[model samples]
Target: PETVTAFQLQKQGSEGSSGERALGQQEGYRVDESGKVYLPFIGEVQAAGKTVMELRQEISMKLIAFFPDATVQVRFLNFRVTLIGEVARPNAYIIPNEQLNILEAIGMAGDFTPYARRNSVMVMRERNHQREFVRVNTQDTTLFKSPVFYLKPNDIVYVEPLKAKQYATQGDFLSRYSPIFFPLVTLATFVLGLSVR
Candidate 1:
């Protein structure tokens, strides 16, 4: 069951009601570990493992006792994604809206670095307490149709570094030590020259 962040209650004729008012507005309501969200007048409703529409309907039904003319709208406020490994700025980002795609997530992370393997981007997701992994290739036109292309809340995108990046890092390490190695070699060469003389 997904968590519920906030809900909107539209009272048909309530005072000061300008269309709809966000119910449980302050910080929004979080579905407790017990898989329930407490509404103002409806008490608690099972929210976990249910879609926004399903929860909305449930809340609407519960509200029939209090406000028969009320309409409810529910949504998730904690929808987020994590971008890591070879991206320009890898971090977890909260999505204001539900709809998110792999490209948009990557872009939010400042796009992939030059070392990133564009053809082997990995997406890790968890569902029903089970984890799954999928690879995507941004270079392929078919990737747009892949199910993993649309990222889910808490989805992790990892851009693997290219082999060239590994070699380049190794080369950088050697270059940093080159100044120390250079002086030693020059001193050794001078000593050898005097010994030969």
Candidate 2:
């Protein structure tokens, strides 16, 4: 129960099954870049800036105005988010529902690696041709409340690794540091012991 409550902030995504979906846009029609989508009997519908659920209701209302016996559904087909950086897999994933959020987006990208800088991740969003950035820390419990937590179409997530990534030769770097740090600490302790004695 607690796990789900924690996950609920971003649980719109289900574990992806391997298969290709049949192509159709019956949920709700999308307005193009020109902001217009054709509904079955509702003519052209404008759907930009509205959530999937909102769009569905709007289309349903329009359909009902004419035919009370008609049933209609609306959803997004091309809506997607892109993830990059220290994740195990970097890719774009389509959102299956209007409820899809940032965690779902990350899950679609195959999750993060051990090296991922959980505190250094950033999200980029575009609205009205202008871009905005939101920083997120996966280590924090309140991350779900962040504006980036709720994704928009075409959002980009970037996960940076710790500065340790800069040390391409880790063994070499460790060897150099260990040799210096080990003796330095030991010598300091030894000197303190002698003075106390």
Clash total of candidate 1: 3
**Residues 34-153 of candidate 2: C-alpha lDDT, one tens digit per residue:** 777865446777777776678778877887776687655665665667788988778766666656677776776778877788898899988778899889997798897888888876
Per-candidate TM-score against the hidden true structure: 0.76, 0.67
> At residue 111, what lDDT does model 2 achieve?
88
Name the best candidate (by TM-score): 1
Alpha-carbon shift of residue 147 in model 2 (angstroms)? 0.7
List the candidate 1 regions with Cα displacement exceeding 4 Å: 1-27, 182-197
Tens digit of per-residue lDDT, candidate 1, span 35-116: 8988775678899888878888888888888677886667666666888999997877666565889998888788989999
Give the Å shift of residue 158 in candidate 2. 0.3
